[model samples]
Target: MTPTVIPIDTPGLGDRTYLAHDGAVALVVDPQRDFDRVLAAADEAGVRITHVFETHIHNDYVTGGLALAEAVGAQYLVNADDPVAFERTPVRDGDVVPVGDHMRVRVVHTPGHTHTHLSFALSADGEPVAVFTGGSLLFGSTGRPDLLGPDHTDALVHAQWHSAQRLAQELPDTTEVFPTHGFGSFCSATQSEASASTIGDEKRSNPALTQDEEAYVAELLAGLEEFPAYYAQMGPANSAGPGAPDLSDPELADPAELRRRIDAGEWVVDLRTRSAFAAGHLAGSVNFGIDGQFITYLGWILPYDATVTLLGETPEQVAQAQRDMVRIGMDPAAMATGKPEEWADGAPLGSFPVTDFAGLAQELRENPDAERVVLDVRRPAEFDSGHIAGAVNVPVHAVLAHLESIPHQQLWVHCAGGYRASVVASILAARGHDVVAIDDSYDESAGAAGLELV
Candidate 1:
């Protein structure tokens, strides 16, 4: 029987899910909270999942192993050292789990990314065939040591270095190496273009393993980017085993119902297109459209405790909106019931109109006479490559934590596109500051406008 690997891409979060085995049993690795694609794939393949495994307690995205277990009556597995509050079958080093007549998975404790990280070695006919090195060893880069904290940098790097060397020495040269995270994942310092690689290739090319432990640790720490504040809340939520979310079909409510919920202090999150949202959204609804970095912005601006009512352009849009919310550690209870049009009754949510290129040019001219605070909400590297003149660089994810440093008056915000600027606008508005989101067109014209970067 040929083993199959399913790549589950949960937009705004990352990739997960593994469907291994010839045909009878499935082993899912790190099925995150937003696993619509994984569920759909499993249903299409007609496979009965037997085991769900989480390599570790994920800090960036909520894990779906518990939910998948509940849905399919599968046993949830994790390393024996995990401090998670769930009843999981603890699999330790050298433990073999029988998959079917001719296959078995050998658990290997490869704890480097976190204190409880695990990897699995797949075997057929008593010979190792593949290895699932969740975060311990990626295709190009190893997992970031900073996840554990600055204090654990040395220990974590040493642990990862030793773990990779162990795998390189123990696993066969021909064994395939599949990692949980790939390119675009914030978890690793340098993710590979491809999702999977062979053990021999990684040993030859991975920089993390080739460098000394101290130098590797220093390089990893220095290259670390600021993660979302919401990341801290995800680890516990994933470990606790999420309760059944309200998966009921959305009921269409009248405008009065939408207005009533809004009045009752529920946050109306408009998941429409930014242009459409700018054209019109429910009075006072926060506009974070479906197209952009919806989950990242959602985590950045929305309060952890706030109840959110989603306004989507289509039925599928609403479902995606709900799924994205769960990915970022927001409880399903926070999701508001009903369709977009139905809930959009009463006065509009307070609108912070976007400024076009021409409007932005005018604002810059006018602000020069006053205390101008131009906020650049891009990543640090992006900020370094040239940014708007006289702009303070505070990444959108780090903005809330560093808000005290931002001047409270007359702040203008812009990102690579308009999406992040809108997110920044919402955050500043909540803080009672006067701010405006510059349209994407303005960012395109920044060079023409003679914006200088320091």
Candidate 2:
């Protein structure tokens, strides 16, 4: 009588949504805004989705519980404490929600990530089998308690301590743990490579479990880096019960309109390889390349409501790009495919000049008098641990708002490799700055780049 669990990963957000079924009926937990995947899972399992659960008002990404439940004619269950604008089944602590004839989930009030969060413990044929921990207790780490802002951070941290310990004390050690965050995702206080775990494994391996309440809270708070600014929009959107937008292929733009968007100062986002974009692109077009963390950077900088013109190499690439955008609640205005030269139409093409580590060293030696800034776009932790001498540290996520860090002269940018460096180079180039992107391996040429490792 074991329930089937279909774990779906959203690689961009480092999150997972699950469809748990008892063969005849199914339930979804913390689904992303896009419903097609979850719907497909239900269809493949040959079960009707009868219930959708939201652990809390999600701050990282919009949960599709409301809209998805509506789409499939299922009941959307939310915490009674959350004053969502729409109608939903109000769930309270210790409530046993029956999924089908053989399986039921007992709601546990595990409020740490948010004040109203609830984790569900699944029971199959009256035996505890697994638990949907949501943001409560992740596999190797716990959810960051600071999403509620400064005033509530300490309180949430304290709550997080008790809630985590409570989960361990209440649930059996053998119960499987399925969490919604911390899969190379920024939502966790720290990162873990684990995809799934059992309660017994978590008790021994999770860092928070080893420390006292005060020590755990302090450690968790100190490890948090800047989260995406677009997070502010997610909670409101999810609470309003977002409707499923048409993720169909956008209208293809002719060269005439592509030129106009460039003239009008709208973002013409180019989705290609970093190497490809570095070679050549339409002047005024910026590259947040499709092959790397495209969606994360899209949310990091682009105005949430802005309609961007998309440029990709092929129709298939553009279509794949659209799904990446729609999953994060972004919709592009138009899409086009072709060479930069074709779209440029007699206008000057823009390109980022890539310098290998050795060549970059030679340039600095030759022109020590030249005014230039070596900008490192890695995280603060990476920069603090070790970095090249005189390279200004500005994480790619925070670069858009912190343009004043630009040194007012020539700019040379490098990340650990070249993917993030390409993103920064594109942003600076769009603003009419002279930017050089380093395309070589940072690890191999630490000596060449004159890195200062501690």
Candidate 3:
């Protein structure tokens, strides 16, 4: 009988954890810091978790491997060469561990995402079932080689190429490919739309398998862009063995406390929808709407060690954001749940104009000399592909650092969609800059609105 594999997706983080079981016993892979989800999964599956595995010391989110293992008394497996501070059952290349009666795992040393990375190939009795390629071999891409830094990038890219080839050559073509990253993850060298794939599918579509090593490395390096700044802290936190998250309600803040924190240069983030925030919000509050990829962009642009106070329409929204934050090793300093009017305590709420690309085109046509600046907040590559003529390009992730360079005139901000544009616009508005957020789809709205794209 084949072991059943259940994917536990953290879509906001663009990662997945696996709960694979042979009916009676189970093993977990690459769990997030909030390990309660894994425990819930185990309970639903009706299996005792007997083992936990780590593919590498992650660079994106704090790992819950040690904590989860200890909670269930499961043997934790990590690479023997990881140099971690915690105790674990360290296994090496070519080592095979039996899991229950029907499943067995063969460890393959597949380095590249990190020096000590390992991929586990699972078999049911004697038949290959699946391979957990944490960050090594993805669906149509590979894990980025530069996360370890520039000094190791060159050698690591080469290693990544070979590691991908090794997996292709060793695993059966029918083996299901279960990767931890690549669904909108910055860890992927490039993104893949395919949610599931087999070794044969990757061998045909993946650059590492189709192109020469030289070509693959050059393309991969050229395409790399800035990842979240918060990534610098994840590996160390995981290495030290992260504890469970503190999901208890944060201390409630009153209107005056919110004002004080804002005046003190702390981040007062609004978690309402972008439109709701634009309609009315506390002055000096930035919008990272809960409806969008809230955690990813917030983690990217947030200044390290800055105190954060979350403002939401309800307590549940704030609670969900808190869970997302702890996965990236952050805890909110305080929280408030109410409308901006309620939080303002009779003070006037601040707001700005929200329009679509068509409205922007009309404004430009109607008042060509209005002293407005159209800002493209998409990534550099997206800007290069196509953008409004004369628009300034500043990727949303780097907007804070490039604030000095942004034109002081009235600004119209946009991204592929509107989420990032709202982020940049709200940041500028909080800083007292004249801003307008283009809440429209760039591809559909730009051309339909008769805007000139260069």
Candidate 4:
């Protein structure tokens, strides 16, 4: 019988955790720090978790393999050569481990995304079923190789090319490919539109399979962009073995206390809709809205050692943000729930005007002589492709450090969509800048607005 594969998606971080079972027993692959989800899946499937596997010491998020294994009393399998601090059942290339009655997993050292990366090929009753390619061969692309710093990047990319080829040549074309990255994860060398694929599909579409190694390497390296700054902390946390996240209700902060934290330079984040945040929020509380790429940007921009106090509209919203926080080994120092008014007590809330690309276009047309600053907060590549003429380019991630570069005039901020622009606008608004967030799609609205695009 073929094992059932259940993919637990963490879309905020663009990663997936797999729970595969063959009737009575289950095996988990590349689980996030929240392992309770894996336990729940196993319980629902009526199977016992007997093994946990790690693809590599992940550079994206803290792994739950060690915690999950210890919780379920399962054998935790990690690369034998990994310099990890915790005890695990060391696995190496060519090792085949039987799982219950129908499944057998063969470990293949794929070594591209990381030096000791391994992909597990699963089979049932001697027939190939699937391969879990974590941070190695992706659905239509390959995992990026530069996360190990610049020195190892060259060697890793070459290894990644060979690893993808080996999987393509060795695995049967019919075998299903379940990769942990490539679902909008920065870990992918490039993004793919495919949700699911087979080795046959990848062989035709994956660059590593179709292009010469040098060509693939050149393209992949050139395409690499900035990843989350939080990633620098992930590898060490995973190597040290992460524990299960604390999802208990955080200590509630009073209005005065919230003000104190903000004054003390602690990150008091507002997790609301960009519009809701723009309309009104506590002064000095920056927005990383729950409705958008909240975790990714928050993890990227937040200082490594900064104390974070989350403010959400409801207990559920704060709980969700807290779960996201722990994946990166961060925990909210405190929380404040309900409306911004309640959090502010009687203090006047801070706010800024929000507009669309059309509004911006009209503003430019009406006041051609006005010294208005149109800030494009998208990546440099995005700005280079096509951007508003005369707009200042400052990627949202770097805005905090490059504030001086921005003029102290009326500022209009926009990103590919409105999410990132809202983040930057909130930050600038809190710093006493007259900012307007353009809360609209850049593609659908920018060109239509008749603004000059360079």
Candidate with the greatest TM-score versus the true structure: 4
Compose the digit string of candidate 2's lDDT tens values, residues 1-454: 8999999998878899999998899999999888789999999999999999988888877777788999999989999889789999999999999988988889999978888989999999999999998888998889988887889888888888888898899889999999999886777888788767988888998866778888988888878888877888888887787778678888888888998887897889999898888788988888988887788878877778877889999988887778777776788899899889888888788887888777678778899899998888988987887787888898988887788757678888988888889988998988888999988777788675654544
Candidate 2: regions farther than 4 A off: 441-444, 447-454
lDDT of 4 by residue, 1-454 (tens): 8889999999988999999998799999999999899999999999999999999999889888998999989999999999999999999999999999889999999998999999999999999989999999898899999999999999999999999999988999999999999888889889888889999999999999999999999999999999999999999999998888888988989999999999998889999999999999999999999888888899888787779999999888999999998988899999999999999999999999999999999999899999789999999999999999999999999998998778899999999999999999988988889998999999999999998999
Cα misplacement distance, residue 238 of candidate 2 (Å): 1.0
Q: Candidate 4: which pairs clash?
A: none
- The local lDDT score (0 to 100) that residue 1 gets in candidate 2 is 88
Model 3, 1-454: lDDT tens digits are: 9889999999889999999998899999999989999999999989999999999999999998999999999999999898889899999999999999889999999988998899999999899989999999998999999998999899899999999999999999999999999988899999999989999999999999999999999999999988889999888888888877889999999999999999999999999999988899999999999888999999999986779999999999999999999899899999999889888899989899999999999999999999989999998888999899999999999999999888799999999999999999999999889999999999988989999989
The worst-scoring run of ten residues by lDDT in candidate 2 lies at 445-454
lDDT of 1 by residue, 189-249 (tens): 6756775689988878886667777777777777777666677787778767775455554
- Candidate lDDT scores, in order, read 0.73, 0.86, 0.93, 0.93
How many Å off is the CA of 437 in candidate 3?
0.9
Ranking by TM-score, best first?
4, 3, 2, 1
